[model samples]
Target: MIRAFANPHRFMALSRWLAPACLGVGALLMVWSVWQGLWVVPHDDYQGGDIMRAMFVHVPSAWLAMASYMGLAATGLIWFVWRHELADMAAKSIAPLGAAYTAMCLATGSIWGKPTWGTWWLWDDARMMSVLVMFFLFLGYMALRAAMETRQKAARAGAILAMVGAVNVPLIKFSVDIWSSIHQDASVLRLDGPAMPPVYLTPLLIGGLAHMIFFAGLTMMLMRAEVWGRRGDVLIARKLSGA
Candidate 1:
């Protein structure tokens, strides 16, 4: 499947309808999850009353932030090893979208924290600090690529940074467990299964699925744009050279 999609034509053809279908379905799921979270689900006094509703947005963003980075890293590694230009395109496309989700995670986290932790930022919290590091890693990946002189150079630089920065993803995931932090630990994903009750858990899971599907649609859309842009560049170069 991976090798099949390595051919840009196949990917473009497949994504044409798949992307829109994913977008439509994901949008519907997102709307339903949001409605359930905000209006249908009963508030949990143990967590933070209605404020727990933010989990629908924050948790999914956080999940996507980490997942997107891993996707970037995996594609980067593929390009680094196999010299696949499509993989490089994928890595490039994932970066900005990953950064956007990371930013959303950080902003929403701060909002949730201010009310619960009584502070907008926590300098010492391991999970918070690790996630912050991951955010910077995303920014640095983009900045490093932009600084390179050529597309090849940019992809090479970005791939190396992504592979190295992947160390942070695990750190972010385990930070809460490894260190003492105010943040709750593994409410949804746990060895013993989710600690959250059904009412809150169901919608939260749906929200996470919605975001994941939505992210996939967005990534495919961005990759499609990159493909078209690259084609345009090729045409411009050919015309300039009278090829």
Candidate 2:
């Protein structure tokens, strides 16, 4: 099945239909979740009233920041082992989106921290450092890919870097527990289950799904663009060579 759809034409056909559907669903869910979170959900007991509402966007963006890197790393693995151009293109295309999400995570986290933690920044926290590392990894991957002259060489190098940098993903997830940090401990994925009430949780889950769908849609669109552009370059080169 993977081999069958590895062809650029087949992938483009699938993405055309799938991308629009995901975009529509994602937009609807985002609207509904934002509305519910801002109005229907009760304010937090400790933090300033209504300020905790940022969680709807912040948490989901953070989830996407990490998830996008994982997706990129997996695509890198496929590209490295299978020598699939489509997979390589997809990984390259997702780097910017992943970096954007990571930046959003840091920005929103700082905003949330200001009111809740009484400070906008902290250096000693392992989780914070891990997030920063994630951001740097994304930047490094993009820079290294762009630095190489040939596409093949760049892809190979980028894939190796992406796979290596993925080690930080696990570190980011467990950093709060692994070391003392100012950041709050895990709440959503704890063994004991969610700490928040259902009212807040309902909107959070909805927002998270919305972000995932959005990421998928965006990634597909970028992948399609990369595929088309690369094919065009190949054809141009072939024609010029024949001439």
Which residue pairs clash in candidate 2?
none
Query: Which one is best on TM-score?
Result: 1
lDDT (Cα) of model 1: 0.84
Predict model 2's lDDT versus the native. Answer: 0.83
Model 2 regions lying over 4 Å from their true place: 168-194, 238-243
Per-residue lDDT tens digits for candidate 2, residues 135-212, read 999999999999999999999999999888886567665864465444454322121243677888889999999999
TM-score (C-alpha) between model 1 and the true structure: 0.89
lDDT by residue (1-243, candidate 1, tens digit) is: 678879999999999999998899999999999999999999877665787788899999988988998899999999998888889988888899889999999898888777666778866566567677788998999999999999999999988888887865676558654664454442322213437778877888899999999888988998899999999999999999996
Q: What's the C-alpha lDDT at position 24 in model 2? A: 89
Score each candidate by Cα lDDT: 0.84, 0.83
lDDT of 2 at 159: 91
- Which ranges in model 1 have alpha carbons more than 4 Å from their true place? 168-194
